[model samples]
Target: MPRSLPPLNAVKAFECAGRHQSLSAAAAELGVTHGAISRQVKILEDWLGTGLFIREGRGIELTVDGRQFLKEATKLLDGLALAAERLSGGPKSRVLRINAPQTFTMRWLIPRLSAFSVAHPGIEVRLSASIEPIDKITGHFDLAIRRGAMGADSTPFLSETCVPVASPDLLKTTPVSRVTDLTAHTLLHAESVADLWQRWLDLAGYRKLQGKAQLRFEPLYHSLQAAIDGAGIAMGPSALVATDIMAGRLVALFPDLPLPLDDFHFFVPPGAATRHVRVFQRWLLDMGLAQSPRPP
Candidate 1:
């Protein structure tokens, strides 16, 4: 039986367009005109019988279906690229794909990533940021990092202590010398870990504490940035906010009541740990150990 397939050219165009969320960017990457990319995407949408993207003013956003399709398409394209590389006996350039939480990647891993690149220039790291837990993440990854109890195929490298953090300027405006003082200021919450503030407050024996105002942000990175900007107080894990604290952009409050969170575990699937992956794992473990704790 002959296999039925959508136009391969259209698929490639749609995949590139979807990945960048920009038709012009996709056109540039694929060495085609913007109209060519748009037509190809339209062909894909028609073939799939669904609207892949919703056009916004001067921009485009992926629909739920679009997001799902992009994940599968990306996986398929990555597999094909790898197969082609192997078949063609291409230059031996190691590409290591890593999946990690968005906020953690921004606030921690990225800052330390350059050192790894300097140490091993031969291996290229392609990082994908997602809010999903490592096990729940889609698509291909050589390894994944998440905060949780250790798993059979994972290694626990670092644990973080949580504390309330506020910008120095905000602290000057509304001092939080005591645990209850947090209630006097707006509480910035990361929707991903909505209960972090409550948990820390409970640990400090203030179970009924509520802030003057609450502002929730999707992805922990935004909340941390809000805290740095003096918008409000936020729950800061030592691993994520140590640099901010050291830079004097934010200050940790009530240091005596530190709430220890789960250790960050890195998962390496069976047979996926190549030499480059092993090197990355060693560098990660070393970085975790060498990281300095937030100052008292």
Candidate 2:
């Protein structure tokens, strides 16, 4: 018996739009115009005799039926892609696009990305950096990493702990032996994590404490570099500065007073579970577990 099916093109359009929750994003993904995606979705809706989308002001949302259908459609598409790859015999070489914060990219992921390359020579990583919040970042990416409260679909990979760090020369010139000692030394600030210093200070029972001076920089990496140059003490996230601390470039001050910050999370888009993406995700989790003190 032949199993009746919806038009695959229409189904693909609906599935993409449903996953992204936006027609424009779906059109971008499918290399079609917005009107084309709208027409295809309407075709699918008409063919099925149901309303798959409810139009809101300047946007659309999946109907209950559409939401339900999208799950099966996504799975079906993923299975089909996998079957095609298997039928072709072996995995295909591809690029995996990843977006992360500028400082984390420069100080952390870039240094560790070579291991992934060695493990999977066929898949190349296309990395991009941003200082904007994850939701505000506009671009196409297979995966994205952000340091904050975990979202529902995000996987927490690394824990962040904040501590004060300074160059050896700075310590010699203006020592920070305790919480109150910061009052005598300059403090370095990063625009991205501007609250870190205040948060740590409050936790250390010095809510009103003020440093002698302050130096502010954007993207975090600059402030850390400034700290290394003996300009001031910077609040260092443990994961980002472990290498510098280990290499004697920056010294961790009051190691026992580390302030816990949000964990880093990686988010994968719906229907993006290709073999290469899965492999890279696993490799990332493994790396995080191995390097991060946080338990799996």
Candidate 3:
């Protein structure tokens, strides 16, 4: 009988877990949940029919079988990567296909992509900018970054929250002193959801205000840019606009917590997690976790 081949991801994950000696650490490196790395390691162990590691107090120590397999798995991963490199283009040339919103990509993700590429040399990043949701089951992309709370199941990734922001200059010397002061400025509305302004008004305790504000595009990015250009005050996504806020181009407008949405997330299609993808995910998460605002 021919030997059964284990799942490629399971093997790759197991190799990382063994090398790191901690599933959580491997997860951080791979930009996946700790549970995901653990399950993959278990799947690999089941196929090999041997214990790979024994869980210790805080971390696990490699078992005898694990140590032996580590050597072989290490070689296997290296060989597979080399083979893929040659077959695709070269070891220095890998591709990471990402689908994100056009405005978000332009204003936020695009500026940071060069840094990612520098860290993971020779990888070509192919970006498909759209507001349309990616069908992970259909492999629309190898990676995705979306915004959402903790409990969302549609995506493998989650974002912090949305925050109200506008250029710092708008805040100073203007009569718009408090949350209610916002009524004086042109409230830019570029959200696809028709009720966005209403929800923001409710958050600001002005839901029943006497007049409505200015409105614009369905996609928020355009209006966000308008806000930057002093067109009006626009609610900015914390994930995509942190750099802007930090640069003093934008500042949070209110103390009240903003409304939450589970619209954004990152998804890696089944069988689509590649080394290049793994590298990119790590970089993205680092930026997100460090720069993102608290979830409302």
Clashing residue pairs in candidate 3 (N, C-alpha, C atoms within 3 angstroms) = 144-266, 146-264, 146-265, 147-264, 147-265
In model 1, which regions exceed 4 Å deviation? 1-91, 133-139, 292-296
Per-residue alpha-carbon lDDT of candidate 1 for residues 98-209, written as tens digits (9 for 90 to 100) = 9888888999999988988887776899999875755565448888888884344466677788998899999887777777787799999998998898899889999998
- Name the best candidate (by lDDT): 2
- Candidate 2 vs candidate 3, TM-score winner: 2
Local distance difference test, per candidate?
0.81, 0.83, 0.70
lDDT of 1: 0.81
Candidate 2 TM-score, C-alpha based: 0.69
| TM-scores of all predicted structures | 0.67, 0.69, 0.68
* Better lDDT candidate (1, 3): 1
For candidate 1, the C-alpha RMSD (Å) to the true structure equals 15.7
Best by TM-score, which number? Answer: 2
Please state the error at residue 39 of candidate 2 in Å.
33
lDDT (Cα, tens digit) per residue for candidate 2, span 251-294? 99988888998888777665565557756766776777777856
